[model samples]
Target chain A: EAGVAQSPRYKIIEKRQSVAFWCNPISGHATLYWYQQILGQGPKLLIQFQNNGVVDDSQLPKDRFSAERLKGVDSTLKIQPAKLEDSAVYLCASSSRTFGYHQETQYFGPGTRLLVL
Target chain B: SQKIEQNSEALNIQEGKTATLTCNYTNYSPAYLQWYRQDPGRGPVFLLLIRENEKEKRKERLKVTFDTTLKQSLFHITASQPADSATYLCALPTGNNRKLIWGLGTSLAVNP
Candidate 1:
């Protein structure tokens, strides 16, 4: 079985430019998540999706960040008008829905490292 | 606000010695705690999980303990090796929500 996959492992852009990262989760996993990991800090949950529908996005910076998991498969996270502080690793993870036997033991992707100048 | 803190500073230890790392939290009671290992330029990999109802869990040479009353978790690596060097992260669910929150992580370096 293949693990979660992410594209454009590293990205560099200007502070005001926009950038997008893509994630293809493990097969059969129903829950997808996007997290921001700043340097020297733990990952912060930006959004979570359950079969293409958002389950939680309370911590996301709604003004400049948005994510979508269409068709309940691959997902994308976008940061517009990126700020200097937006330089961080964007991690994508997936797990079986926490409803039955499968709890939320997330499997993370390699992550996209973004550097804003 | 709920917050989780791991001893983020790197820990250096002899290859044959044991290594212990700590995770502490404030203002929230977690249902369970999890540990993950992250190597340079790679995403975190799950190592262990211990619920509040459980006291300890072990796998191979890795051990994890959770203390709800103390809002902390401890991770131990026995018979450590250079291969064990990496950042260890601890995480817990937020409130009644299912979203997991993470700690900054403790970096460990096992020297030969």
Candidate 2:
């Protein structure tokens, strides 16, 4: 079984520019998540999806960040008019269980390292 | 406000020794806590999970202890090796138990 896959291992953009990252989760996984991990800090959840439906996105910056899991297998996270504070690693993870199921182990992909100049 | 904290400084240990790391939290009663290992520039990999009801759990050379009363968890790697050098993270469930609140992580270096 393959683990979660992400594209563009690293990215650099200027402030106010737009950037997007992609994620392909493990096969048969029903839940996907996007997290932002700043240097020297733990990952902060940005959004979570269960079978194409959003389960939680309360921490997402609605004004600048957005994410979608269109077909339930792959997802994308976008940030527009990016700020210097947005320079962090964006991680994509997936789990085999449905949302609300506790004790599920999440498999993570090699995150995309984004730098905003 | 709820908060999770780990040792901010890196820990250095010799091979064959035991490495112990701590995770402390405040204002939250998580049902369970998780531990993960992350290499530089890579996402974290799941390592262990200990519940509030369980005092201790072990996997191979790794051991985890959870104390709900103290709101703390301890992760230990026994017979450590140089390959164990990495950042170890601890996470607790949020109020809803649907998401996790994470700690900054403690970097560990096992010297040969």
Candidate 3:
């Protein structure tokens, strides 16, 4: 089976410009997530979706960041007025289990590397 | 606020020696802890998972031990090989599926 897939493996834009990254999760996975991994830091959860509906987005910088998983399949993360500090890898992951499973292990995509100048 | 810390210093070890990395957290009660291996320019690949109720879990040469009281987890790679070199990340779930709090990964270098 194919793993999670992400497009535009990389992106470069000006600080004030807007950029978007795309992710296509593994087939049959019901949970999708977007995470921001700053340099030298662990990934911080930006948002999570369960079948196209948001489940959590507490750490997301709502002022400039937004994401959506429409049709409960592919998803996208957008940043408007990007900041230099936004340069990092944007990872997308999916998990395929429900309430009965002990724990859902997420499968991650290669990630989109964004550089803001 | 919940915080997770891993040894920021890269671990260097001989190819044949055993390698161990540690993950510690504070101010959170995680239901499960996970380990992932990330190579340069690639996303992390799941390695192991240990739940709060479980003390240990092993997969191939990898072993993970979790101590809820200490809010710590240790990852061990026995009879390590140079191919085992990579950054190892530890993560914990906070109340929901896939909403993980991660620790800056521990880089390992197994020299042949």
Candidate 4:
């Protein structure tokens, strides 16, 4: 089976510019997640989606970041007015299980490396 | 505040040796702990999961031990190879079991 797919493996943008990353999760996977991983640090959950509804997005920067999983399939994460601190890798993951139960193994994408100058 | 920690220093070992990495946490009671391998520029890949009720879990050459009382976990890679060199991360489920709290991974390098 195909793994999670991400577009534009890398991106470079200037501060205050807007950027968007896309993710296509494993087929039939019901849960999708977006995470930000800074250099030498673990991934931080930005948002999670169960079907088309959001499960959790407490870590997300509502003023500058937004994500959507439309029709419960493809998802996208956008960061507007980017800052230097936002120059981290954005990862997309999926799991076969739904939220609210025990956590399941998550399959991750290659991730999109963003460099904001 | 809840926190998870891993060795910040990289572990270097010779091939054919066993590599053991540690993960410690405080102020949280997780139902399960997970380990993942991440290569440079790539997302983490799940390795193993050990529940709070389980003492240890193994898969092939990889072994994981969880101690809820101590609030720590150890990940072992036996007969290590150069291919096993990567950053190993530990994660625990949040209180709601709906999210995960992650640790800054420990890098391991198996020399030939």
Question: Weakest 10 consecutive residues, lDDT, candidate 3 chain A?
Answer: A97-106
lDDT of 2 by residue, B1-112 (tens): 9899999999999999999999999997888899999999999999998878899999999999999998989999999999999999998878553687789999999999
Off by over 4 Å in 1: A98-103
> In candidate 2, residue B13 scores what lDDT?
99
Ranking by lDDT: 4, 2, 3, 1
DockQ class, candidate 4: high
lDDT of 1 at B15: 94
Report model 2's TM-score to 2 decimal places. Answer: 0.97
TM-score of each: 0.96, 0.97, 0.96, 0.97
- The model with the greatest lDDT is 4
Candidate 4 Cα RMSD (Å): 1.2
Clashes of 4: 0
Candidate 2 residue lDDT tens string, A1-115? 8889999999999999999999999999998999999999999999989889998899999999999999889999999989999999999999888556577788999999999
What is the CAPRI rating of model 1's predicted complex? Answer: medium
Q: Candidate 1 on B1-112: residue-level lDDT in tens? A: 9888888579999998999999999998777888999998999999998988888999999999988888889999999999999999998887555678889999999999
**Worst lDDT window (10 residues) for model 4 chain A?**
A95-104
A9-68: candidate 3 lDDT, tens digit per residue: 999999999999999999999889898888777888899998999999988999999998
Off by over 4 Å in 2: A98-101
Give all candidate RMSDs, comma-separated. Answer: 1.4, 1.3, 1.3, 1.2
Clashing pairs in 4: none
TM-score of chain B of each: 0.96, 0.97, 0.96, 0.97
Best by TM-score: 4
Worst 10 residues of 1 chain B by lDDT: B92-101
